[model samples]
Target: MSAPSSRSPVIDTVKGLACMAIVWHHLAFYGPMSDIAQPLAPGLMAFLYDYARMAVQVFLVVGGYLAAASLAPAGTARFAHAGSAIGKRFVRLMVPCAVALVFTVVVSALVRTWMNHPSVPEAPTLAQLVANALMLQDLLGEDALSAGVWYVAIDFQLFSLSVLAWAWVRALPGRWPQQQRAALARGLIVAGAAASLWFFNRVAGLDMWALYFLGAYGLGMLAYWAVQSSRPHGWLAAIVLLGGVALALDFRGRIAVALVAALGLALAQRMQQTHSAGRTLPGWADGLARVGQMSYSVFLVHFGACLLVNAVVGTLWPASAPINALGMVLAFALSLVAGRWMYLRVEQHVPSWATALRWQAGLVGTGLLVALLSNGV
Candidate 1:
């Protein structure tokens, strides 16, 4: 959609809510605190553990929507320098990611001594550290240094894939009509999404690649175009059909979540377009939007924050369900605080190659140092 440069309250609100879900999902999924607290609210813990992870589907769709908005609002490549754009995107994602990983590695090391829980990642090898810094840990068969870090890698891959697709369309020979060019570009996205939904996504082994998640991501791109089109209903219907057929063929709850999120985004944007005057949101919504704006920071740092809280709480009150429940709450609060700090100090700043490299080096260096110190001790 040809959205205004101004931020969308709807998108931000969705992100904020999804971010909260992910944080809570991790809290419930990774234990000690959740283990101790589950007796108090078994059903609630079970639901969070099982269902809340689907919130990531919302992020995938939103990521696609934003990628389309930035890369090709009119269905053609907007930027001339594909390589430069890809590089910039990498730096933008990894600078903050590296910083967060360093924190996570350090926290994991500190927690390893006293907390022999499965949630604490073991000491990193140099290879593992380097792989993680390069966002290749999954591909290299190394354990993730933190929860949800895989999303950061997948995000970069999806963005790069989208950029390359648009760049390919833009490079086609002959004076093709702009409409035809746009159609070709969109056709590629549709085909990729279909391949993902019908094939790659079904194969668990392919989860490390962008193709496996393109179904959700492509729905987001389509949703953006649908919102921009005069015949939005028709485009929206196509989205529904695509997702419906995929689900009918093979029912995946994550895919359904993605489909719903994409449709919700389209409908919300349409409503905003129809009522342009009432743009101001209520205070709570405004707060949510703020959280959404910084959601990436929260996502990056929360595992370490929650880990620290878990270690402390489990040590002091291992048998107290109420105390452990309160510890969960405290962990959530600390995650928010840590997220705000990261957003303000790191994410909000414009990223650079130097900054990204320095942070990456720091992550690897710190990880090696931790390993060495642990060995000496």
Candidate 2:
């Protein structure tokens, strides 16, 4: 999700919990550690493997909520410069992502020497490196260097699509009234979401594009509008009906998860608005909210951190279930530490085109160098 300029405790709590679920899902899905440790708790491991990835739907909903809040809080485009807004969003997402990719490339190379496992990626080609830097790895059919990187590309595309939609409505001819323009923009989003849930999402081949994921994202956008509307009940009911029909059509578990998350977020915002008189979160919630603030960093760097832990722990105790389980915990802790470092160093800075380009170039350059040295060139 794109980082939000302001914070909501409920949003942060949802994001923080979902971020943890995603990290554990990856650990269970890709591991020598999880493989060996499965015997200790097969049910838990299986649940994590199969169901925890639904946390991604939470992110999609949250991203849409934030996008709506930032771009059109009052149901209309607030800014005139769509290009500059889109460019800024790209730089903000890619600068941290480029740093994470470079780290993962180096980690994969090191793990490849001694750990002969499927999780370790091979040396990159120049084309692959370039494609990844440009966020075209999935579109071009190049393997990603790290887990969850595809989300970054999808996020960029979704934000761009929303920007273009709002801009198009604003540029419509013949001096339409503000209310009419806003209605047109909202209608376009609703149409896109309906198409996605009813058709595009079921195809499975269009996962790389924004259309496939727009249902969840658009629900989030509608949730934001629901919070702003005077008749919140009607808007909330519309959200449920949209997602309910999608589920009735195909019964996707992920869409169900998104629907629940979107409803929860809308309800939470409604409560916060009504009860805004000197309320403060407890200590635990404040801590979780802090984690939510740094979630993008955690999501970016956790894969590499987990890979290194997997290599070390697998080498040390390949068969001890207890030890491997402990290693999983250790990896999760280190991932948080690495994520905090990334957040403070990269994501917090004011992103610029120059800074984004430098990081992108560094990722490609380092990947090419690693490939050359691995091949004895």
lDDT of 1: 0.92
Candidate 1 local lDDT, 75-160, one digit each (tens): 99998789998998899899889999999999988988898898888899998999999999998999889999899999999999
Q: By TM-score, how accurate is candidate 1?
A: 0.97
TM-score of each: 0.97, 0.98
Q: For every model in order, what is the number of clashing pairs? A: 1, 0
lDDT of 2 by residue, 1-377 (tens): 65656688889988889999999999999889999999999999999999999999999999999999999887789877999989988999999999999999999989888898898889999888888898899999998889999999999999999999998888878888888888889888888988888889998999999999999999999999999999888778878888989999999999999999999999998899899746988899887787888999999999999999999999889989999999999999999999999999999888899999999999999999999888989
- Which run of 10 residues does model 1 get worst, by summed lDDT? 1-10
Evaluate residue 161 in candidate 2 and report its C-alpha lDDT on the 0 to 100 scale.
97
Superposed Cα deviation of residue 150, candidate 2 (Å): 0.5
Q: Report RMSD (Å) for each prediction in the order shown.
A: 1.9, 1.0
